[model samples]
Target chain A: MSEPTSQPATQLPSRDAANWAKPVDGLKVGAISPEATNLNVEGKQLSGPLAGFGQMWQKTYRIRLSGADVTPEQVIKLWKENFPQFWPKGNRFFGGVGIEPGQVAVLNLAGPGGLNAPGGGPLISTGIMVIYADDESFSFMTPQGHMFAGMITFSAERAAETTCAQVQALVRASDPIYEIGFRLGLLKEEDRFWKYTLTALADFFGVHGAEPDLKIVLVDPKVQWAQAKNVWHNSAVRTGLYTLAAPVRWIRRLAK
Target chain B: MAPVKLDITTRKINAKTSILDIRGEVTGSAESILMAAYAEATAAGAQAIILNFGGLEYMNSSGIGLLVTMLIRIQREKQRLLAFGLSDHYRQIFDLTQLDKAIGIHPTEAAALAAAG
Candidate 1:
């Protein structure tokens, strides 16, 4: 095998600098204080869709704003500015430093294991890294131990001479346990999550009563058993343990 | 900014490997073309595939996600994937997004092919 070449940074061809994020040792969540119990995000490695253990899926949720008197750029800008407002209830998105590259957004989601809802669990605290952002689109990559190991992109474009807003997610369950959740109700719940989000987004532009068009594709059906060990970093379990140990940490802090 | 478009050319180098000569920007709009190219490579029954990124200019986060999907698909088929000619920026991107851990990154197609061999 040929040896890997080590080219100096200057020797590389020029690229659009603004399109990528600066290299980081680990994730650094910014100034936005998280409202949820955050435990699984700090210092975690960013995980792409390939890192997950479950079958891969591509899901798209789109809505047309034909007569809303808004351009694609306008829609994207507004969407970025008021992003958290569009999320479903029982979920909180803390947009730290406003969706720019290299930033992190903390998320608190209600579910069975984390939130401890009547039928559900406890609140799951996780985060996503803003890997790329532009005028028309932005995408977030999940961290290790997150529910879904993957990326989600939100973009706006002109379709059929009318403005369209879309959210495309390529993801897989981060671990085997979550894969079980995905096979049960997590997948449908996710579908509902994005559908409600898009509806609210369309409603923001005065396009009331617009239904989101949904598309789901199974990119790969084979489960990655080798990645089953990812369960060790499972955010739900980690967050729960962190919550249980909060008083211990508080006492330690007082002693310090 | 110019509208980003993707052009993919698949060439089988041997019975075991094929190279995907991808040119232009890989963004959200390039999804269909990338997926189709990957499908063609898989259908050709090549055991390993090398992605030539020498002509690639820009690839946003969504494009990275697509590559991740491709990685999963290739793995499901029990095939291997190698990539070459990514600029320093994208090399950093690969590491940042942990894609480098999933796919081999080489400085040249020749090196990638050698590694595949």
Candidate 2:
């Protein structure tokens, strides 16, 4: 727990410390690296889990750094700085050098078809907006057309004198097609992805051989049928087609 | 300056409506309290759940995630979920996250109760 800082008596209590992002009408991918493909996220509205068509799930992953003498702030700072490094291979993250409120991050995640599929399942280019950031915690909200319409929060806190880092996600498949993919082994892969990330994070903090705790709750089992049309914006399909058309675009550029 | 503390207590609005009076700052620390309060409200057979945020001073992104989880739980039960007493800034938070569309937001508890009908 953070203690109140001594301030001049005139200072007022305010939310200045939270570092929340200014409201935006929709998402804008600003200053992405040339290597990153920004396809589905630009101009899309931010979508909460409620905008999705699949069953809602709340998943929490935690790993305790038992002997590390780091504060919650230190843990979060390290996590934010090395965010992309913890991810598994093949996936790419681009954009901000540091995670801060309102920054957009472009992600080229492995598609649902897995690595065995044709063209190695291609890649799904999507993105998230950093909605809020504080010393001990920060969060990212997915934009419309992302695989999961949801928010994922990364927080570090002390639990019983042990420093614990956590990643909690409240998510649902953005469309019917994603829901089908999630039902067919994609969910387990997603869980493994986070678990591996957490393990890497723990290793970074010098906590070798640490096992992370995973908790998943099915908050809502029924799909929201009204959001069935979200499939029209499937990012995997768009990114795959974009990749497939690279040759044609190159030929046209040569002609010009 | 004391750290934010979240407290939740339930009040009966009618035979079918119950309001969860939420006080203090809501952050990552408030998760258990909020979940317990929601469980209590539902266990008492509330068809409509209204969260009164009148006394809330601050809420971080984690708090918003908690609300979304509660909303899903409420939806699973087919119960109505509504919220009231948001300061303009907090209302904007709801808007930016699109939670305003998921759960109805009202300016006052009375207005929320009226809408529960």
* Winning model by TM-score: 2
Residue A103 shift from truth in candidate 2, angstroms: 0.9
> Can you list each candidate's DockQ?
0.45, 0.33
- DockQ winner among the candidates? 1
CAPRI class assigned to model 2: acceptable
Q: Residue B105: error of model 1 in Å? A: 1.6
Model 2 pairs whose backbones collide: none
lDDT of 2 by residue, A1-256 (tens): 1221121233234473357887798778888778776788888888888899899999999999989999899999999999999987767778688898889888878743334224443378888999998888899999878889899999988888989999999999999888999998788888888888899998998999999899999888889999999988888778878888888988999999
Per-candidate TM vs. native? Answer: 0.87, 0.90
Model 2 chain A: ten consecutive residues of lowest lDDT: A1-10
lDDT of 1 by residue, B1-117 (tens): 226588998888777888888888887668788888888888888889889877777787777777877787788789998998787777888887888888999887778889989
Candidate 2 local Cα displacement, residue A68, angstroms: 1.7
Residues A1-256, model 1: lDDT tens digits: 2233333445444455685677677787666653456668889888778788998899999999868988888988898888888988777787654578777888878753224433232468788888888888888889889999888999988877889999999998999999999998899888888888899998898888989999999998878898899998899888777767777888999999
Over 4 Å off in model 2, which ranges?
A: A1-18, A111-122, B1-4
